[model samples]
Target chain A: QKEVEQDPGPLSVPEGAIVSLNCTYSNSAFQYFMWYRQYSRKGPELLMYTYSSGNKEDGRFTAQVDKSSKYISLFIRDSQPSDSATYLCAMSGVGTNAGKSTFGDGTTLTVKP
Target chain B: DVKVTQSSRYLVKRTGEKVFLECVQDMDHENMFWYRQDPGLGLRLIYFSYDVKMKEKGDIPEGYSVSREKKERFSLILESASTNQTSMYLCASSYGGYEQFFGPGTRLTVL
Candidate 1:
């Protein structure tokens, strides 16, 4: 089984809509979960970061992790046109050499204006 | 903000030719990594370095090699590039615990 799995969604939403993206992992050893946003022809940038489980919020974005269910989620409030991009879920265990991260395929999101 | 710059934004090479991809970071990070992104495969790590002159192979390192001669620069070398080696390559760097910062990927096509 893949360590992490996410919906490869070409999810579309209105400009002012709230967007929800999710990821599930099979490995319980994963302690770090991160969300990255990638624009076309650009690099991935960190959006939300959380260690272990629970939730972390930053501005209009909120990231939630449920270790018991091995699931994680990212919610975007009042999504804007600038938020259109591919959202990737990545995770790794906490320890030395934790630089190696396992990535999900990414969900392509488009917010219409 | 930390900046990770890749040498090339795009490259086209003939099969069997030697290819070199370079990455540099201005953040003075202790770890650097090379990963490839395919259509459906997402990103798979090829190699990484934790400290200067110290390297380790990642999940997919069959047709690639890496060099970390300096703390700020890491190089990925394809000694004999093949068509299958064509893909979007990403370079990233980070401290031990935080999320990594990725470079603008290099899209390579080996014909």
Candidate 2:
């Protein structure tokens, strides 16, 4: 099985709606989880980052991690048209392995007006 | 602000030709990485460097190599490029954490 799994969603939603993107991993050694946003033809940029399990909120984005279930999620509040982009979930283990991150296929989101 | 710049935005190369994709980060980050992004494959790491002249192979390193002659610059080299090497190449840099700043990405097409 793949170390990490995420649905490649071309999910469409209206503006001002709440969006939830999620990913699951098979590796229990993963300790750090991250979310990245990528626009078309551009590189992925860090959106949210969390270490271990719990929740982290920044601006309109919230990242949650549950190590027990090896599941991670990113929620976008008050989604806007500008928020339309591909969201990628990435995770890594501790120590030297921290530099090595495994990424999901990414979920594409489109927030329309 | 952290800035990562790639040498090219788009490139078209012939098969069997050597290809060089360069990346430079102004943040002087301790770690730099090279990854290829495909339609369904997501982002797969090709290589990474922790310090100057220090390099490590990532998940997908075959048919690719890397160089870190300076602290700010990391390069990805494709020896005898093939059609399979056609993909968007992304460069990222970080300071020993999960936060990595990515470059604009180079879309390479091997014909």
Candidate 3:
């Protein structure tokens, strides 16, 4: 099995709808969780970052991590067309492997007006 | 704001040609990484350097090598480009390894 698993959904939603993107991992050592947004033909930019199992909120986005189930999620409130992008979840462990991150297959999202 | 700049936005080369993808960062980050992004495979790490003159192989390092001669620059080299090597290459840098800033990416096609 892949270390990280995410549904590569070309999920379409209307503007102002709430969107949730999630990822699951089998590794238990992951302590740092991150969400990245990638536009077409562009590199991914960091959207949200959280340490350990908790929730972090930034503007209209919220990132949640559940270590017990090895699951992480990014929720978008009042989604806009500008929010249309591919969302990737990345995680890394502490110590020796801290510098390297394992990424999940991204979920593509399109918020239409 | 941290800026990561790649040498190319698009490149096409015939098979067996040597390819070089350059990445430069202005943040003076200690960690730099090279990753390839494909349709299904999100981003696979090719190589990474924690410091100048030091490099480490990532999950997919075969047929590729990396050079980090300066603190702000890292290069990924394909000894003999293969069709399988055609993909979107991305470069990233981080100060403490938690949050990363990425470049625009280089789309390379090996025929």
Candidate 4:
């Protein structure tokens, strides 16, 4: 099984809708979970990062990790058209390995007007 | 602000040709990484350097090499470019944390 698994979603939603993106992993050793936003033909920009199992909020985005179930999620509140992009889930082990991450296939989100 | 810059935004090369992708970060980050992004495959690390003159192979390092002569610069070399090597190449740098700043990717197409 892949170390990280995320649905390749071209999820379409109206503006102001709440968006929830999720990813699951098979490696319990992964301690750092991150979410990245990538526009078409562009490199990924880090959105939120959480260590172990907990929640971190940054403005309109929230990241959660559940080590017990190896699940991670990114929640976007009051989604806007500018939020239309690919969301990538990433994780890494502790210490040195924390700099090197295993990334998911990414989910595409399009917020419409 | 942290800034990462790539040598090219797009490149086209012939099979068997040697190709070089360059990256530079102004943050003086301790870690620099090279990754290729492909549809469905996501981002796969090719190589990384923690300091100048030091390099480490990543998950997919075959047919590829890296050079880190300076702390701010990292280069990925394709010994012989192949069709399969045509993908979006991304460079990132971090100061020992999960927050990695990325450059605008270089889309390489090997014919």
The TM-scores of all predictions, comma-separated, are 0.97, 0.96, 0.97, 0.96
Q: Would you list the C-alpha lDDT of every candidate in the order shown?
A: 0.94, 0.93, 0.93, 0.92
Give the per-prediction TM-score of chain B.
0.98, 0.99, 0.98, 0.98
- Encode model 3's per-residue lDDT on A1-113: one tens digit a residue: 99999977989999999999999999998999999999999889989899999999999999999999999999999999999999999998888668778899899999999
- Per-residue C-alpha lDDT of model 4 across residues A1-113, encoded as one tens digit per residue: 88899987889999999999999999988888999999988889988889899999999999999998889999999999999999999988878767778899999999999
Q: A15-92, model 2: which lDDT tens digit per residue?
A: 999999999999888888999999998888888899999999999999999988889999999999999999999998
lDDT of 1 by residue, A24-62 (tens): 999878988999999999999998889988999999999
Candidate 3 C-alpha lDDT tens digits along B59-80: 8999999999999999999999
Docking band of candidate 3:
medium
Pick the DockQ winner. 1
Which stretches in model 3 have alpha-carbon errors above 4 Å? none
lDDT of 2 by residue, B50-98 (tens): 9999999988899998999999999999999999999999999998877
Candidate 4 iRMSD in angstroms = 1.0
Off-target runs (Cα >4 Å) in candidate 2 are none
The CA lDDT at A15 in model 3 is: 100
Q: Which pairs of residues have clashing backbones in candidate 2?
A: none
- In terms of lDDT, which candidate is stronger, 1 or 2? 1
